[model samples]
Target chain A: SAVISQKPSRDICQRGTSLTIQCQVDSQVTMMFWYRQQPGQSLTLIATANQGSEATYESGFVIDKFPISRPNLTFSTLTVSNMSPEDSSIYLCSVAGTSRVSNEQFFGPGTRLTVL
Target chain B: QQQVKQSPQSLIVQKGGISIINCAYENTAFDYFPWYQQFPGKGPALLIAIRPDVSEKKEGRFTISFNKSAKQFSLHIMDSQPGDSATYFCAASTGLGANNLFFGTGTRLTVIP
Candidate 1:
């Protein structure tokens, strides 16, 4: 299992402002992912943060709105730019376990952003 | 298109009873299915998972039943307790190239005493 941590456990930001969430893992990981959980909703994959190259984003998401940076194997950051009421959600970072036998993904505590 | 579909957005079960949540996937390429449990103010944690090669896998009181032909799976919690109450999510992944996962909406479970 991988131990994951996130910064800014909870933040209240003004509309139109941007917030950058950080994720760090205890061990080197091959893949890091960013996810969003809206109020009363399930987890939505935001993007896959690649170590050396650009992140792979899912549909309905883009790099312009949610920029991701992965400088190394153990660290990555996701920025929610030009925030709005719709952007107020819990952002989480996750890492798949290193063991090839297990595909389990461990998640961080999550950064809860409230846009006012 | 939603790759995974879950049923019973919310469930209420009595203590000592069984709580079951079901999910179905549209993609035949999905080879790995996992269920996650999430509590308020917390990120999801993997509860149990099953590969298409297996029909079922059990861990303690939690069991995952997978039907490859039906493209469906379900989570069964035996002897439900109040502490078991939380939101559960079903997700699928191809486990190939990138291994990006597609998650379902979620099921809120309440175990009443």
Candidate 2:
């Protein structure tokens, strides 16, 4: 399985501020996805961070709110811009491939964000 | 709309008993169904998965039973243990451009000794 790590394992941000979360994988991957897990809620797909193109946001998510950058195949970042109280959630980064024990995707530990 | 519905918001099972979690999907385009296990302060890990081509798939103590015609699938955990207590999620995804998985609400499983 790929070894994935995220910076700022946990953070407390004030409303109207922006916090960027970085995801780094030990090896190159073809697909990297960002997900959000709200308090006591299921995991929600935020966007698909493409290596060279604009990130593809989900239906209820917008690029302005969650901008993503994937400079290389092994690294990506998600910036929660203009954060709000409702934006408090655990943000996770995942990679898709066959390198893992399972055919499914492998995820990072996750970045815990709490907006006050 | 692609939505995977899961059942049993919470469950309590005794150790050495069987724990079952069911999930249903409305979209037939979903060809891949995967179950994930998540512990507190951790990301969800892929537990097991099954495809439409097979009716059931088993991995050690965990099994995934799929009903293609019914668009429903269930996870069975045998010989449940205290260490198996965690929140489980069922997700479905299509083989479209990108693998965008739609997840269910999740079921909190508590295995008591």
**Model 2, runs deviating above 4 Å:** A98-103, B96-98
Docking class of 1: medium
TM-score of chain B of each: 0.96, 0.96
> Where is the poorest 10-residue window by lDDT in model 2 chain A?
A97-106
The TM-scores, one per candidate, come to 0.96, 0.96
State how far residue B87 of model 2 sits from its true place (Å): 0.3
Off by over 4 Å in 1: none
Which window of ten consecutive residues has the lowest lDDT sum in model 2 chain B?
Answer: B92-101
lDDT, candidate 2, equals: 0.92
Pairs clashing in candidate 2? none
| Local accuracy of candidate 1 as per-residue lDDT tens digits, B41-112 | 998988988899999999999999999899999999999999999999999998654377789999999999
Proportion of the native interface contacts kept in model 2: 0.65
The residue-by-residue lDDT of candidate 1 on A1-116, one tens digit each, is 78889998999999999999999999998889999989998788999999899999999999999999999999999999999999999999999756674566778999999999
DockQ of 1: 0.64
